[model samples]
Target: MNRLLCGLAANPALPPELVDRLIALAATPPGPSDLPDPAGLSADYLADLLVRNLSERADLGPAQVAALAALDEDTPAQLAHSGHLGAGDVDPAVWPLAALALLDEGRGLPEWARRFAADPDPSLRQRLASCAGLPADVEDTLAADADPEVTAELAWSTTSAPVAARLARHPHAEVRQSVAGNEAVPPASLAALLTGHGLPPARSCLVCDGREIPFAHDPSFQDVDRDLPAGAGCDGTHGSTVHGTWARALSNPAAPPEAVAGFAGHPSVWLRLAVAEHPGLPAEVYARLAGDPAPRVRAAVARNPGTGPEVSRVLAADPEVDVRRAVAHHPRVPFDVLGQLTPTTRLGPHPLPPISAATPEELARGAASGNGRVRMLVAHRHDLPPELRDRLAADPDASVAKAVAPHPGLSPERLRAMVALHGQQVLARVAANPDAPGDLLAELARHEPSARRALREIASHPNATAEALLPCLADGKSRVRAAAHPALPAAVVVGLLADPDPEVVEAAAGNPSLPPAVMAQLLP
Candidate 1:
């Protein structure tokens, strides 16, 4: 009886009675081990059946469709490689089933589907050419395809602005229509198209999270006071006149120079700050922003990569410490300017002892200072003597010990010795420390699972071995299992998929390296 039912499920052209029985089986509530073998045959056998089902236009109902969809992820690719689907040989009626079975689910286009991007069948090409997460190279090829129908899909699906621009001017009206309605079309393109056609500027705004703003621009526009007094302006409410301009101006990449110049003096600091950060702002406008009363605007000006070196020089001397810091990190700033700026080091209230002034002997003396802050400063210096590092490693203070743990100058043996001597609190620091050695990480992995916090940190440590992470997979804490999931091998993750904790299962699912067979088991 089971064999008869399985045969009918695989046979799309069987008599009506057999087809009805297969539909009834699909509707039946399946038992745990009695789960229907989507195709009650081997994968290779099922692939051959699908090719024949489409080759002859056999009557198959939706239940038959569901059964076909239930095939494993690899089944579609197998059929494609067998030359049944892609060489313009498969019947058009079954293209939908083939597309669904082969849909690469957040992965890029399937290896087989690339051949069909320009397939003679318009429907086939349209079904496979998805814009969602398509790789850049594949998207480029499809965007430039000779077929208007194929490239029209690019207008709606592609996130690439340049592609959208090309589609906007496409000779085909349908392709242009798709570009017109596409939200990804930049505001500048929309503005140009509207103006060229002598149409009025769109009263509806397209800036609020890419949706059309319902309210018209306020005719009696008033700037919100810099010191916002209660409910005076776009306190983030949708309709405020100030809010409309703010959203539109930010979205308009080609916002005119006059508007940017006007915004530079707008009463709202946010508006001025945005103008200050605009990459297209003229050098003179940037110079003006350098001295804006708002320190934030000045800071934006200081950090804008396009800001001239002279402007950066002025900003380096700005009274605001953050503005000077921004200039210090600026790429164009001369070495002399950066050297003149105060080092942003914060190990202590006092500055680090300069190499010119303080010998390693003097710095080592500082490291021995009873003052914890002074010792903390010495702990940060790269020039510390090897003996001094060992002393700092054994420092009773947690802060001193942690500060020393990450110092790359500390030898691996010194780190391992410190891990053995320090309390769990310091152990946490060593586990997270980037320069912590593989041997020390492996040892820390052997430390008791009861140190959940330390174990969690060790699970994420790049240097921590698979052996170290293996124990944490069964840890009582969810985060430990979560942290260990990414580092574990595929076989380990397969075992973890059945873990009682839903959180652990989720973490396992997130591992990109999970095998397809394991992933099939994990499917909802």
Candidate 2:
């Protein structure tokens, strides 16, 4: 069996599935053994397994791990389990706190959290910060905790007012987001968030001029119109551009009513569009833009989030195709309005960004989106549960298969299946990746001679041609041919002069490496 599988078997804590794989590995005919040792399995098989699986014998009474190092696996169960960690010099990977947290699951949470909170490991402290509902002092301690992640959590918990009040200025952007989201940020602290330029608390419902809404990106790049190319700056005449740019800058959802009112009538349609589409704009602004002379302005109003479901009902009824289309896709449009607009095909000519994964249901629905890029995106989601990955594997689009091919999450059998079904072009991508295992390289070479040729080309040097003819002199595949002789190794060329293949005979005859005797063999 391979060293890695053996290593897993040696490790006591390893899952049973891994052990089963290890047993199968031992059964493979050991390769020529000439293969260079892989980094992940640098240790020889048996020793690696013993080290990784961790013999329980060491866990017994080893207050002194150095002494226990000599012990064998059959020592005892409690000794094995306890010795695994308390052995003192155990690998730091065995995070004591994460283990402590797991044990705390069925018991009093606060006590366990507090216990680990005081642990020396900074990483452990950081994890406990997410435990929430701690005493106020514990929250305060974590709020100012040196770790950015810990401090961010303290700022995020609503139960801890003290931590929130102080977290507004935390250097970490995520910490600031937690403080910004806290409703109790005593008005005085609001300016701090404004000055922070909305760093980490990236998502929110607030869309006022100075308030940063969470989850909003600079939508200036979305393709709202197919006729207009992305990033095409308007000649002061483009109302949609001006309005989108302006409305997105609102920090508060409900503006200082006056600043909100004047923007609706700005001379530029762009400015009017901005006011119309503002997520926070009051109904009065929507009423003004709904009747706007510029049809584009009305379209922006239909798409604006600040417009309520009651108002959307009226706008979806508009005669303009663009306006009705905009209303159909707006995130805030209630499902009932969506149903009314269903018969319309106004999904703008430009493709929309992949939809936000707002719900498990949305994610499930996304798997069915007809767009190739959208399907590709879903196929590669790291969080894609196993069943979905299989669906992606089965997707007819080679492009989607290519997207999913590199994920380590795929089982070896699945990867082999992909290589088999998808063809040589897919194998080239896998081979070119630095992280791909050499065994896979060998496997692909064994499967398709063309893949080896491609890989040989990729591995060749500047002096070598793209055909990768150099390695062929020694390649087991006699099809590699003598003329496939690489640029160097003068002695091989001398020997090749008598080759039966004319191409080999000709190439070797021309080589300066051939000695007089070998040169004589090439002549009449």
Candidate 3:
């Protein structure tokens, strides 16, 4: 067991499930004598060895570091005081690795790591930032580092609220995304970042950055689009390229009401439209926004989940066809309101975004529409009627058929026949269906040599048998090799752990069926 535990610690490629098991075992009580302190073995040597085991060659990736970090925090301190480890005994070259080992054990790094925690070298600072459970002061300093990469790493890896707050306003989008993803981020800080607003245009524009001049005298700063008439200036061409700060923030469910409220009066119609749809928004705010002069904003309010029946009634009578259509489709709108709207009513702006999740009846209604677009909308619905699905499956429109081809409702015979007819496009979905019979899956797995996507889907399907999975192990696609790992036998997985592909090896290490002897073999 000791050897297996140590092996797991060294092997970074192990899957999350095995990592979890290792964490549990590490927490279990071992007899005081069970911890073998071999005679003449120095603690610093053991520490160095542990750090060395965490290198890329040993599979000590981020996942392993994080999983190990969650275990009891006493491991590092215990080892440091165990008479084996001595101050300055650790090699200077492996200081960063030493810091990671201490962090995984939930302890602050000793003299070496602390000394260089704020080192001018960005790489060294980045290494320290990646360590979880570092001293608050150390983490806070790293969070404020001018190097965005260091700050970004700290944002992603730190649990310290102060550190997260310090980096909340980082200029870099990647850094902000990291801060937003951290659970420890303050609600106020998150809200501030989430509020939808446009910043002043940057120095360079992606859309305007490159344009081949038609001639020396040509005066146009527009994207190259053959569809546009020559000299159609960049104006009114490509829309705003500014980041969707509000949209990204609203994606986080933890966003505070105050942050959302910040966007209530934003000038951008698109931003206002997003604000109208925010969940649990104040009723008064909803009422105020419901009356927005912008048709798009009103349409958004009409479709918003928080829009009350009273506001929806006003929208039902709105002059704009898009607003009326939004109200008509709104779940909260009265049946009378829906009955009043004609099928000719426009369904909001072009390329309409999904305002809300539709019910089965809405899907059925959409499926029955003569308009191909409405029927296309029905194709995205999860619970289409059997008759509608079958009809759509046979629809001459390729997009509609493509959408319906993946439906699990199709019979095995139908799916099998579809594979031959539809070819690669639908084959992946057919292979993914859990209802697919074992024999059919095996046949497809063996005979279907083409379409790597289908092969991957087949390899990962819950119904895939050992025979079905065997071919996937040798599949050229790394995704297929990884997906095939769980289903492979113990002997097969042991060999696969040494697979050339990092992802495949990672998957193999995570296989639950790995033999005890094989696991022990991976130990340092």
Give the root-mean-square deviation of each candidate in angstroms.
13.9, 19.0, 15.0
Cα lDDT listed for each candidate: 0.56, 0.50, 0.59
The predicted structure with the larger lDDT, 1 or 2, is 1
lDDT of 1 by residue, 103-162 (tens): 434422344456566466765566556536565666677777766667767776777777
As for TM-score, the candidate ahead, 1 or 3, is 1
Candidate 2 residue runs with Cα over 4 Å from true position: 1-97, 100-112, 169-174, 182-192, 195-281, 285-306, 309-326, 329-343, 346-524
lDDT tens string, model 2, 441-491?
Answer: 446544544665444533332223313334334443332233333443557
Clash list (residue pairs), candidate 3: 12-59, 42-84, 43-84, 43-85, 44-85, 196-246
Which tens-of-lDDT digit does each residue in 371-443 have in candidate 3? 6656654564445678877777776555555566667687887767666666666666677766787677777
* Winner on lDDT (1 vs 3): 3
Q: How accurate is candidate 1 locally (lDDT)?
A: 0.56
Top lDDT hit = 3
Each prediction's number of clashing residue pairs: 0, 34, 6
Question: Candidate 3 overall Cα lDDT vs. reference?
Answer: 0.59
Q: Is candidate 2 or candidate 3 better by TM-score?
A: 3
Taking all chains together, the TM-score of candidate 3 against the true structure is 0.42
Best by TM-score: 1
